[model samples]
Target: MNFWNRALIIILSLCFLLPVFAADKPNILILGEDAAGDSVPRSSRVFKRVLDALINQMHDKGFDVYDEAVLTLLENNSSHIRRTDSEIIEVARASKRPPIDVVVIFQIYASTQNLEFNTRINTLLMGRLLNVKTGKHLGNFEIDSGKNFTGPAQCQQECILTIVGDKSRILANDLGAVLAEKLVWMNNGDVSEPSKNNKMVTEYALIFDGFNAKEYMAIEEYLVIFSGYTRHRPIEIRHTRSEIWYQSSIGTAKLDRNLNKMLAELDMQSIINFEGNTFTVKRITFRNKEIKENNEVW
Candidate 1:
C-alpha cells in the first residue's frame, strides 16, 4: 500500500474509535453530611475516608466524579457569600473544569446497641441527587449496611469504615444507574430522534413588553398551536408589560423562530431576547393598528 493509503486507513480507524473513547458521561459531585444534617467539613477524617471509598467505587463504574478539593477551594474563595445548597451548586457549576452535571449529597447515620457483652454499630447511608442546571431534586436512595459489627466503643470508626468499604460498591452502582437515566431524560433522548411528548420538560418565563391586550391575545393563540408547547401561567398582565411562565419540550432556538414567524404574520414588530430560560419580547409595535385605540399604549 502507498503512504497515502495507510494514512487514509488510520484516519478511518480513528474516526470509528473517537466516539467510543469520547462518549459523553455525566460529571458528578458527591457531598457528605454531618450528624446535624449540614455538609460535612472536608477536614473530617471520616468524611475523607467515605468520600475516597465512594469516589473510587464510582470511578470503577465508569463515572467522572468531581474533585472534592477543588470544590473546597471554590467555597473558601467565596466565603463571603452565603453557602446554601443552591449556592454551592452554582459555584460548582461555574467553577467546575468541564461542568458539574449532577450533585449527590449523602448522609451517614450511625447507631449503637448493646448486644450481650459487645457493642453493635449500625450504619445507614441516605443520598439525594440534584440536577445542577435546574437545581431540582432528581431522586433519593437509602442504603443500609446489612452487617453489624460488634466490638469495643473505640472501634466505632473502624466498624464504620468496614461498612463503607462493603457498601460503597452498591451505593455507587445504584447512583450510577439513576444518574444515567436522568441524564438521558434531561437530554430528551437520542439527538437523532424527535423529542417525545413524555420526555422531560423545562419551564421558561416569557415576558411581553409594549404589547396591547389584543396583540397579547393573538400571541397566545399562536402559542397554543406552537410545537412542543405544553402550558403557560400568567404572572402579570398589562398593556405596557406582561409576564408568563410556560413549559415546553423544545429548545429556545425553535421557540424563537416560531415566535419570530408569528410576529411577522401578525404584522407586529418586536425584538426577542433570551436570558437563561427566560424570554423577553420587547419594543413591540403594531404596524397596522391604531396606537390610540389601546389603553395604556406605549
Candidate 2:
C-alpha cells in the first residue's frame, strides 16, 4: 500500500476509536471517616475493610478508583494527609499523580436498631462528592442497612463485624449508583439541576444608569472576563442605558460579591443596589468626572 492509503486507513481507524478513548472512566478518591469526624486510621481493620469494599463497588460501577494503598503512601510521605475531608481534597488536588476527578468522603456509624427493640443493630452510611477543580460540593447520598438477615439478637464483636460488612456492601453500591447518575447529569449539561444539596444556577438582570456607550462596551468586556456566564452574550446594549443579564452557578449573594469586586477596578464610581433578583446601578462619576445625578427609571 502507498503512503496515502496507509494514512487514510489510520485516520479512519482513529475516527472509530476516538469516542471510546474519550469516554475514560472517572477517577475518584475515597476517604473513610468514623462517627467522631476523625480519619479512620490505617490500623482500624473495620474501616479499611469497608473502604476496600467501597472501592470495589465503585470499580464495578465503571469508575477508576485511586488505590487506598497509594493514598496511604501519600499520607505517610506528606504531613497534609490527615483524615478530614478538606485535607483529603487538598492533598488529592495537589498530588501530581493521577488527576482526581471527584473526591468521595464516606462516613459510617452504628445506631440502635430500635428504641424498644435492643436486639438488632442499624448501620448508617453517608457519602459526599466534591469536584476537584472548584472544590464545590456536588451532592450527598446516604444508605442504611437495618437488621438485614438477622443472625444474632445482640451484636457482639463478630456479629457487629458481620452486620457492618453487610451494610458496607450495600452502601458502596448505592453510593456508586448515585454518583454515576450525577456524573451523567453533569456530562449532559444538567449540572445546574444537580442533586438538591448543590447551589443551583441563577440568572439576574441589572439596569445601569449614566453608563455611556464607551463604558457600556467596557462593562461588556469585563463580563466576558468574568467567565462565569453559561451564555456567551450576557449583556444587552441600549441607547440611553444598558441592561446586563447573566447566569452563575453560584448563589446570588456570592455572585454579587464577585461582581462588585470586578467592577471596583473600572474608572467609574457607581452604587449598586439589589432588590430581589433585579439590580439597579447609579453612576455617581464617569471617567473621574462627577455626573449630575438623575432619578431616572429606565
Candidate 3:
C-alpha cells in the first residue's frame, strides 16, 4: 500500500485497538528547532518533555528510546535558533545509530493573531516520522494549543511542555505506537536480545550483524527467503526449496538498467529481490520453473 493509505489503516487500526506494549528497543531521532523569537527560553529542553514522556511510556511498554535538543545545547540568542532544515536534520541524525528505523522530526511554531481586545498567541507543534536511509515521508501530525503563550504571558517552559504533552499522548495513543511497532518489526524480527553476541553465528552464516544499544541489527542481503526450504530438511515435513541468488551490487534494477549493469558483470541468475518498498525474499519467486534472469533484497 502507499504510505498514506497504510498510515490511514494504521491510525484506524490503533483507534480500533487498546494501547499495549511494544516489543523492541526504539531509537527515536527527535528534531526540535526554535520556531519563534524572542524564542522561548529553554524551549528545546521543554520540547524534550514530549519525546521523553512518549519514550518513557513506550519504555514502560517495553521499548528502547532516545532523543536530544540541537539548538538548546548551543547559545540561545545565536543564529543556531535559525538553523537550516538540513542542519537540524544533521543534528537529529547525530543522536542515532547507523541503521535508524524511524526519524521523528518536530517543529515548534509560536505566533500571534488578532483577537477581541487583546491578540491571541499560541505555540503549535508539528512532527512526522521518516525512514532515514530512504528519505521517504512516512507520516505527519500537528496540534495547536489555543492558549496565548507569548513572552510575558507564558508560564515559561511549562506552558509549552504542557502542549507537547497533550500532542504526544494523543499521537502515541493513536498513530505513534502502531507505526513504531511496524518499524520495530522491520528493524529486527524474532532476533532475541542476545545473551551472547551472535557475531560468530552471523559470520558463519555470512550475514552481517551488529548490536545497537541492546538490540542487534543484522543483514542477510544475500539470503533470499526461499519460502519453502529449511536450512535442514525432514522426511515428511520437508517440501519446496530456495537459494540466496547473489548479485554484485545490492542496488535494485528499479532505478535503471545502467545501475543493473554497472553494479555487477552480467549474470543471469541474480535478480532484483528487495526492490522499492519490500523487506524480505518472500516478495520474489520462481514462475513456470523460470522466474526471470536474476534479482532480490537490500
TM-score of each: 0.43, 0.47, 0.39
Predict model 1's lDDT versus the native: 0.62
Off by over 4 Å in 1: 1-108, 111-120, 124-203, 234-239, 286-290, 295-298
Model 1 weakest 10-residue run by lDDT: 16-25
Model 2 global lDDT (CA atoms, 0 to 1): 0.60
lDDT of each: 0.62, 0.60, 0.40
lDDT of 3 at 144: 61
lDDT of 3 by residue, 152-173 (tens): 3433445545544555445444
Query: lDDT of model 1 at residue 265?
Result: 96
Stretch of 10 with least lDDT, candidate 3: 232-241
Tens-digit lDDT string for candidate 2 (28-113): 78876542633334345556666777677665554557775564465433333335665667766764334566777877766444
Per-residue CA lDDT of candidate 1, range 1-298, in tens?
A: 5558756864663454321112434557876544353333444454566666666655554455667666456443324222346555665577323346677776656566756676776656666777776777877777665787556655565664565445544554555455445445554542222224456555578889987555777788998789887655555665467777676788888988998999999887889999977789985555445545443343
What is candidate 3's local distance difference test score?
0.40
Cα-based RMSD of the predictions, in order? 17.7, 18.6, 16.0
